[model samples]
Target: MRRSREGYEIYPVADAIGGISPTAHDNAMQRMIQAGAQPVNAISLVAELQRDWGRARADELRSILRWYFPKLQEIRAQN
Candidate 1:
């Protein structure tokens, strides 16, 4: 939240972050949103960073996705 207020584009990974309690987590998320943070899931963040499939780092990105998120790869294969 402070980072957002300082003009940084904050991208908080929703699933990757946690708090002591569910209510605390929800409140923190709300505060971050109010302070200009953009919440995103892991897959969405990766997709945003790898916008172009034909980019030079495409293979590397895909490899990372495969390693860190095998289910994502499975879903892609099914599609």
Candidate 2:
């Protein structure tokens, strides 16, 4: 993940999920594929499974405020 001064600072999904290393994420994704999980990236999985701001979206809108504002107070610490 690159850290830009004016753009989004990308983070590894595995890191967000369970602090798993890159190698681990790769292995996990591979295992998931073998297990028939559509071969999605870790980031996508996090965005799908993580319920942020009381409004979890099919997309990665956890960073979007307007749609997730309702659960801000409760999830701020987690954020």
The global C-alpha lDDT for each of the candidates, from Candidate 1 onward, is: 0.84, 0.52
Residues 1-65, model 1: lDDT tens digits: 35654578888998788999989999999988888788999889888878899998799988877
CA error at residue 39 for candidate 2, angstroms: 3.9
Candidate 2's C-alpha runs over 4 A off are 1-19, 40-79
Q: What is the C-alpha RMSD of each candidate to the true structure, in Å?
A: 5.5, 13.3
In model 2, which range of ten residues has the least summed lDDT? 10-19
The 10-residue segment of model 1 with minimum total lDDT is 1-10
Models 1 onward score TM values of 0.59, 0.31
Model 1 regions more than 4 Å off: 1-3, 55-60, 63-79
lDDT of 2 by residue, 1-79 (tens): 3334565443334333431577776787665455444544444655566746365453455455445555656688787
Error of 2 at 8 (Å): 34
- Backbone Cα, N, C clashes tallied per candidate: 0, 0
